[model samples]
Target: MASPKRPIRIAGCSGAATDRRDAMRALAANCPNDPIDVIIGDWMSEANMTSRAASKTDNVGEAYEPTFLEALEPALPHIAKHGIKIAVNAGASDTELLHSVVTKMVASKGLKLKVAWISGDEVLPAVREAQKANASTFENIRTGEVLNSWKFEPIYAQAYLGGLGIASAFLRGADIVVCGRVSDASPVIGAAYWWHNWQRSNLDELANAFVAGHLIECSNYVCGGNFTGFKALETKGWENIGYPIAEISSSGGVVITKNKNSGGEVSVQTCSSQLLYEIQGPWYFNSDVTAILDELWFEQLSTDRVALRGVKSDLPPPTTKIGITAKGGYQAEMHWFLCGLDIDAKARMMETQIRLLLRPHAHRFTKLAFTKNGSAPDDPTNQNAATVDFRVFAQAPKEEDLMPQRFLRPCIDPIMQGYPGATPHLDWRQALPKPVYEYYVTLLPQADVQHKVHLASGETFAIPPPPQTKTYPAQQPCQAVTRGPADGGKWGRTVTGPLGWIVHARSGDKGSNCNVGFWVRHREEWDWLRTLLSVEKVQELLADEYAGKKIDRFELPNLHAVHFLLHDHLDRGVSCSSTYDFLGKNVAEFLRARHVQLPVRFLDRGRL
Candidate 1:
């Protein structure tokens, strides 16, 4: 029998394009004592993809993320000295350009690093061709709306690639692998696959690495960033929050930890928070393998170390997510403050006046909204505290329609006739029209993507689609588990307060949809939580945002969590969303702040 291979440690240095730039250097500096074999960085997201597409359309900047270069320059020496492999999907739309630049940087530094890049993620030509042949191929994944029904023309499209291309680059002796539009966890999956010489048949091991990759893909997220129990890190301080490292054994066991003596934490709760982030349902799908998250478990091994286990898997999905970007329109906003008494009445009067003024050219506007944020205190301490903000938001197909004269004039016309203490914030830039892009997310067949890897040895090879694939139902079949009751069972004594008193939550966006995952620290609480929080309950608690909107709910018993997906919740995502919580990061907090009946037994345990 073959000897068991040793475990490999992979560190995540970045979560997004805008994450802290010094994380790479920080992780590299600690590698002398605490060695890591590979460093993976995830730098793409729906929001940044829209921005990069627009930048490319207007020839204002490179389509790729420049921050990766900024972060890599400082850590190049340490990375070369330690001989650590690096993989990142920061290439965005221009992998070749980024590869060229990085190669030049390596040569300038006199380092012997061999850099390679993977491409074929850009599928604009294919998407356009499909649109001409059969538009149904571009059906929106969430809404089921066909692409022909969309108002704007898609200028750019990129399919989510798997990690096999990265693995191919590694096998070809490349020290650094740069990719474009690979799945967020692709870097980690590719690293693990290369380290263990995993084959396509190693479904469970790949799934283990997939989940581990998801957990640490966001860098400090598994190390206490975006955690609900942030107060727990008070002594350690949040300023220098540590990045996460995934230690994956040859047997498919995984342990999550951070740098020695670093700030923040790596507990089970922190791992659970990252696990539930931005997920759609119990089955976490990827191009290479589908992870069964319902049975996954996390255990605290020691301080700053948590073990993740029980993750199961099946064959890869036949299709992968693809995002197409188009110019939605131009948008502008105006803000007015309503102070002291009669806040609602003042807001109503201003809305009436603005609506009357805008009624003339309403047909030209695609979207118009009058929103009020906060309420004035009955008896306040200061003027600032007594003020509530009222906003007038407008979107139009043409920039001229959202210009200061067209959009802002109507808002300003009502000011003199407004209620007492109604004051305009008076920021001209806020009312000036700015271009916005709409991101349409759908699935593209894996076979349609021409996945290819360009090696440092001047050879290019195509990566075929996964040989084994499965087609799952649109909705995951319900599990056979049973719960207590919808009302959370009869606890004799109960108290009314915020749901957050005993619950910890994390929320994020998936295109225009928002997913909020809520979990408890104890098993007893999970019983009550699963029974109490229902689809109807969520609609009631978030009536303003979720009322009349479609919501999908699922339970992850192993993680002691319940998740909710709010469809069309963010007004078509960040670039065009008008809501204050545009990214949906605050949806969990919003639900937590809602008052609910809580059992005294759970409350007595103290707030999370």
Candidate 2:
């Protein structure tokens, strides 16, 4: 069932919130008079996935992003015209449901598709099975704690089922491969490698296809939405975002481009930024075959096309990345306030009054803050009466715990305190905090992890075992925390524990492969931070913000500040990580349960 050996094409979209189907249809129609056999649409982020799942539970489809379904609506008609098959990860959390919707819609018109509806990657069902079997809750390899289920929210629930899954679906005579969620690059890699019959020995060749997939993975980020030059533009369209496409060659080289006469502009800078998104630093590790982008180059094929070349393979690492999802408890928040005229002055007065009001038990509160409606810039220039606000952070294991206190602490502000300049709203209490637990998960990089390529009819597509890197805990410390080895260049500094002051510094091109972040203190000051945020804690907050959405994976192990990999968290054959979905078992939490301490330490200032 394999096709010709020509290169495959793919694209990343550039609009703010464009439909995936629209972009895909445009892609098929605008394809450069070339024979394109496959197309991929990456539609879910970790947070978005969570949102999708939650919305489904609530029976309200209005809240979820409709790009995938909408895009499929029009795209199916267009692709059906030429028999161009497509594989996309845009079904949100309900792959079966998404498939049903697409199928019913297409069938309504008396059209039938040899469509393959697929599912099985989110760990929610696995969790139920494991718990039923009295199985061990897979732990995060980093920390040594069992997950608290209540706190877990699903961000994305895709399986890292390899390209073969989709190809096999296509080979079974299916026209479209509908996946709940898969790896970000696997779709492109699957489309290209499967068609060309590129096997495992062709790992290097597959690497080329993967690189092309990676390029267009970040949507408009690689084109112009995030262009830093700012002024160099004949035009820029943030509204009519352009989706990317890779005219991939079976030989591993590709021409990255977008739809014809698109709204956004493409250039070297845009594409370069995308090339750095969510990829492993040493190189992107794929089934032990590392696609080395360290020495990669991009050529301007035209106004919208870019050529990628010079990607070499690296010796594979020994550790297989263990994907584990575990239970964490739930967590929720409320923005209760204490406001008044001279609102800023009133807020400061209350902090003093409350500290005195609580008279010594003030420390009982977990989190309490007073500011100009937000965290610090401490800017005198931003002073405004209406712009002031205060926030309190609280938590408990139950909802009633918050219900009693809903009005317990809020209304007391207006009645208990006095501000000469204040007099307006009578409602100081809006709502109370509702408690939800957290799901703690982790990804473990270990040996013996299996990544199989499943053929369409349930056969195995064997791959030549690519190389992988394996290292002990170094008996020292991980550079991401303690100082890195002074190779004279790529070392990092991390800050931990309490300090008298705090400052935030972010470096590296946000568009670069590695966006570096660090904390700084004066040379004269002792290494102290007034407050320190654990990289994991920050990710938790990020998760909270993106509650119920599929999110990108964040690698805190290498970066000084635990840089976040923007987008590109879905694809095939890559480990179908379930960290983003509501995990009864989270891999990060799973690993820690095994009592394994990968690495954690104080920052070393030796190189500084």
TM-score of each: 0.97, 0.64
Off by over 4 Å in 1: 1-4, 478-490
Tens digits of per-residue lDDT for model 2, 1-608: 44366556555532222433466667666555644567776775444544555555567674335666666666666677767787777655666666666677778766666566554445554444544676655543223344334334433323344454565566567677766546566677777766776665676777777777766665655655544332344346665656677787767777887666666766655665465444434356543245766466667777887887678765444433323322122222333243333556666665565445443333444333333344333345543523444543333344444443442344244434644443323343334543231223333232222233332344543332234353434111112222222231222343332221122222121111122222232321112211223334334433523333222222222112223331222211111221222211122222112221111222332211
| Candidate 1, run of 10 with poorest lDDT | 477-486
Clashes of each: 0, 121
lDDT of model 2 at residue 555?
24
Instruction: Give the distance in Å from residue 105's predicted Cα in candidate 1 to where it truly belongs.
Output: 1.4
Candidate 2: stretches off by over 4 Å: 1-5, 13-21, 28-37, 51-67, 123-159, 230-234, 287-289, 314-347, 351-389, 404-412, 415-439, 443-608
Deviation in Å, model 2, residue 316 alpha carbon: 6.9
Query: What tens digits encode model 1's per-residue C-alpha lDDT throughout 543-580?
Result: 67764767888888888988888887877888788888
Q: What RMSD, rounded to one decimal, does every model reach?
A: 2.1, 11.2
Supply the global lDDT for candidate 2.
Answer: 0.47
